[model samples]
Target: MLNIALAQLNYTVGDFSANTTAIISHMRRAAAASADIAVFSELAICGYYPGDLLEDSSFLARCDAALDEIIRTSAELPELVTVVGTARRNNGPGKPLHNSLLAIRNGQIIAEYYKQLLPTYGIFDEYRHFEPGPQTACTLSVREHRVGFMICEDGWNQPGLDYKVNPFDALKQATPELVISINASPSDIGKRKKRHSTISKACQETQLPILFVNQTGGQDQLVFDGASFAVTPDQGVVFEASQFEEDFQCIGFDAGAFMKDGLPLLASALVDLPVEEFTRRQILLGLRDYARRCGFSKVVVGSSGGIDSALTLALAAQALGAENVIAITMPSVWSSEGSVSDSVDLCKNLGIRLHTHPVADLVKQFSTGFEHSFDTPLRGLPLENLQARIRGTILMEYSNSFGALLLTTGNKSEISVGYCTLYGDTNGGLGLIGDLYKTEVYALSRHINQQAGRELIPEPIISKPPSAELAPDQKDTDSLPPYEVQDEILKWHLEGDRMPPAEAKAARNHVQGLQTSEEGRQLVARILAMVARNEYKRRQAPPLIRVRSRAFGSGRQMPLAAKY
Candidate 1:
């Protein structure tokens, strides 16, 4: 019988000591459970997305030292074999590195399997730092079974894809009875279902039981929702792990069969929660990990009583606990009583501390200083932006005084159109929901209230028309296309990169006869133009946690001066 343990835990980039400590704790647990082998996720030692840190020799040396220490410690546990991911320097001339999964047995490095395919698209730029391994598979003798190893991107390909060298093709030589895939795959809606289906098909074809282990928690803008599992050769799941959490589970297999001894496999159908539940869980995980990894216990957010700020407060409260989350409502002369009441009630419902700081007096004080210099009154974008900047200043002051991290709340729709004020609404240390579209924001809000069985967000906050309230009665529709219409165009133009002709036809169809005028086409064209022009603003924005296939970070690169 082969007892295997999946170690799904959080890791921080470049923090070798902390990562090693996590690995050691899991190893001890697996040893106590008497598991024959324990598998950890990709880059479990160095943390995934190390980015430019891989170029530092000292950093690499520290990682190597950590690995040496881990190997030395593992030697004491003779009953357990460990397979975990780390960065390894190539022996060849010139500095070539590889993302490797090393097998340690009896306190010595027994074998290593390098990643053959380094992902280059989207959030992954592995090819920039690591050289691809030779097309081959490594098999280890563990618990009287031949066990094969594959990394995150290795198991994602079909057998004969041209762009990648499939690990399955390499597995022909080893013909192992069992396979273990270590991954640091990021979370997206419905991604787990697709991943499970792929793993099951691979196991069925190879007739080998497969154990898939993934990392949990967030790293910068990426969140790894661990839903690790093991599947039998017959496509039946043997064991399933939890999502958005750190967990360790052990499963026993005998001769390519899951050993179920009277006890049923601890498994359930994959979660298919409402989009709100998914978003809430994602944001909570993102916030919690950001704080834990960055060494911050408390968070501060500027509550504008808008949907964006309200949702941000909800997520922060869920993640850092009500006691740890602090909300500041900075209202100006334009701010309405309803806005203040709604924000206060929302905070009360969530049990968070609310601080009200009226900015009307401060605005007047600042305006008096500039009154002499400017002949005309500041009534355009400058006036609106000053209000946002004042609120930002107040939030940052609290953050600096208390050593708390400020979470920014701006959705993708507004971000794409450059609707946000730089150094104002975008002044936070991290952008929590920057990847979510505006429509998605409302959807998630509705989901949150539904889950609570009562209104957590005030009724006016939901039913009332969406507005920024930056100026007198400023509604979102006054400046841009409706969110439903805009989001469709964005998905097609930004994601699909469709041509103007195609995009125009799509926009027309989406808006039906409402936006068919030539003037409307010009407006749509202008919106797309603004998105293309504001790439620089997004480039400077705080790292946004990704929950989609395409995000506005390392993945979406656009030339600053290029016309396209």
Candidate 2:
């Protein structure tokens, strides 16, 4: 029987001290548990996806020192085999470094394998730094059991996929009893389900039981959900770890079946989290980690009493304690009485402090200065944008005075169509809901209330129509289509086939129907043009917590100078 320990940890980029300490602690724990093998996620020594940091000679030197320390520590636990991921220098290679996995026992490196598949797609640019390993399978013998190893993207290239070579096919030829795949997979909507389906398919094809280990925690725009698991050819996923948090588990492999304690384990399906709940957890973790890592305990938000700001404030309050969140109501002459009152109510419900900072006088001052200098009345779009800019400036001032991060409130719909003013509503350190559609912003707000069992977001705020309150009777619909219609068009245009199956089908059907009529066709063309033209604005916006398949920041790249 082979007892394997799975260590699912959260590693911060460039923090070598903390990453090495965590790995060694987990290694000691695995030894105390009397396990045959202890496995950690990819790049546990230096953290995953260090980006351009890989180019620094000092950073590579630090990585080497950390690996050496881990190797020396393994001597104390000679009976336990430790598997870890780190970067290694490639003397003869295309790139200067190789993404490598090392198996250590008794202070010696027994087996070392370089990752063959370096993904260069969305949110991944592995090919930029690390040279791909030659197409070969790496296996090691442990206590009469043969175990194969593969990195994150290697196991992903199952049959009929995009990659030229299938790493799993090479592994099957070697005929190991089980496979151990280390991953740094980032989380998104429906991604956990896709992982299960893909890994299970690989087990069936290779007729090999597999142990998949992944890292947990937020890394800027990417959040990794550590839902590690063990899958058998006959039972699929039998033993699974936790999601959205750190977890560790030890299971037995005996007679070709997984065992917990001593008995055969029953296969259980991964329960799918509700869409709103998944989004809530993802954003909360994202905000918490982003703020903590950036060295801020508090956050400030511009609460316009609109759905977007209301939701952003509520989430910020939840993520960084209500006491750490401050809401500023920057109302102008165009702002409604309900705007201020609703913000007050929302803050009261959330137990957050609210400050009223009127911007009417400030807007008047700006208009006077502009008219005097430019000899033109500050009217129409400029005036409307002036209000937003004033509010954004006030929020930034609060953030500066309080040493707190400013949170931007624009949602995906407005962000996609260039509806937001540059340097106006976009002034913040981070965006809380930039990936969410206007429709999703409302749905998640309601879900928060339902989960709290009270009106945490204020019922009036939820019931009110969304508006920037920058002009008289300014509804979002005056500029763009209703959120329900616009969001569908965005899903079809922005994400396309990358969306989940149900959403992709729905978007395709919606766009196909829209193309049936001339007016509908014109509207579709206009939205597409708006999205294309807004690349410059989005390029300048702060990075948001990515909850969908294709968010505006890192996932979707477009040329600002080009027209389609």
Candidate 3:
């Protein structure tokens, strides 16, 4: 029997000391548990997805030193073998370095395996730094069992998305008893389920029981949900780790079956989380990690008593204790009584602090200055935008004075069509709801209240119509289609086939129904024009937590000066 310990750790990008220490700690824990081999996620020594940091010689030097230390540290547990991901110089390659997996035992580097597949699509840009490794399979014999290894993207090349290799096939040719794959896979909606299906398919093709280990925690826009698992042709995901958090598990393998504590894993543990719940957990973890890593323990949100800000504040309070969340209500002349009162009730219900920072004076000052300087009264779109800008400026002042992170509250609907003012509501260090549509924002707010078992977001905040309150009685519907219709159009336009299967189909049908008439076609054209014109605005927005398959930023890139 081979006892394998999988370490799903949360690592800091480019912090070699912290990353190395974390790896060593997990190695020691696995050794103490009498594990035959301890496996870490891809790029554990220096963290995964370092982007241009990998190009720095000093960073790689630190990684080399850290790797040497880890090799020496493995000596403390003489019987345990360690497999970890790090980078090494490719002295004779197409690229300057190789993304390598190191195996160390008893203070010696036994074998080194370089990643053959460099993913360059979507949020991945591995090809920019590292060259592909050799085509040979790596296997190490331990406890009378032959184990194989593959990096994150090596085993993902299927018939549809064909790369130059099929790593599992080569590894299977070696007749290994099992395969262990380390990954730094980022999480999104339905990612865990898709990962399981892909890995299970590989197991069936190779007929090899496989152990998959992944990294956890947030790295800016990307969040890795460490839902690692063990799969076999017969059982398919027999043992699984935790999701959206750090986890470590040791499983046993004998005669092609995986057992946790010498027994089969429960079937109930293999189910997928509900997609909404998955999104909620991902956002919470992403927000917490982003704030923690950026050195801010507190967050300040401009609460407008709307669904977007209400949900953002509620999620913030939940992620980083209620005491750490501060809500600033900057009500203007156009703001309704329910706006400030609902915000007050929401803060009280959430046990968070609330401050009134009325922006009517700021709005008036900006309007007067604009009319004087330009010789034209700032009204219509410009005036509405001034109100938003005033509120944004006040919130920034709070962020500056308190040293708390400012959280932007614009949802995907507003963000897509440029409904948000550039320097106004977009003046946050980070955003919590930028990836969510207006419809999803309402759904998540309801979910939060349901989970809280009380009206934590205030009933008025949940029930009230969504508006910027920048102008008198201004509602979002006056400018854009109802969210029920606009969100479907957005899903069809922005995401296309990349959205949820059912959602994409429904959205396509809804968009077609809208396009059947001249008015519907004109509405679609208008929304498209706005989305295209707003690229400059989105480019200036701060990093937001990504929850969907096709989010803004790196997941969806658009040319600022181009027309399609």
TM-score list, all predictions: 0.93, 0.99, 0.98
Encode model 1's per-residue lDDT on 24-134: one tens digit a residue: 888888999888888888988889989889999898999999999889889888778989999999877543898999999878889998988888877789988898888
Query: What do the candidate models score in CA lDDT, each in turn?
Result: 0.83, 0.91, 0.88
What's the distance in Å from true for residue 357, model 2? 1.1
Best by lDDT: 2
Sorted by TM-score, highest first, which candidate order results? 2, 3, 1
Candidate 1 TM-score, C-alpha based: 0.93
- Number of backbone-clashing residue pairs for each candidate, in the order shown: 1, 0, 0
In model 3, how large is the Cα lDDT of residue 184? 94
- lDDT of model 2 at residue 276? 98
Best-to-worst order by lDDT is 2, 3, 1
The 10-residue segment with the lowest total lDDT in model 1: 495-504
lDDT winner, 2 or 3:
2
lDDT of 3 at 134: 90
Candidate 2 deviant stretches above 4 angstroms: none
lDDT of 3 by residue, 227-254 (tens): 8988989878777888888988888888
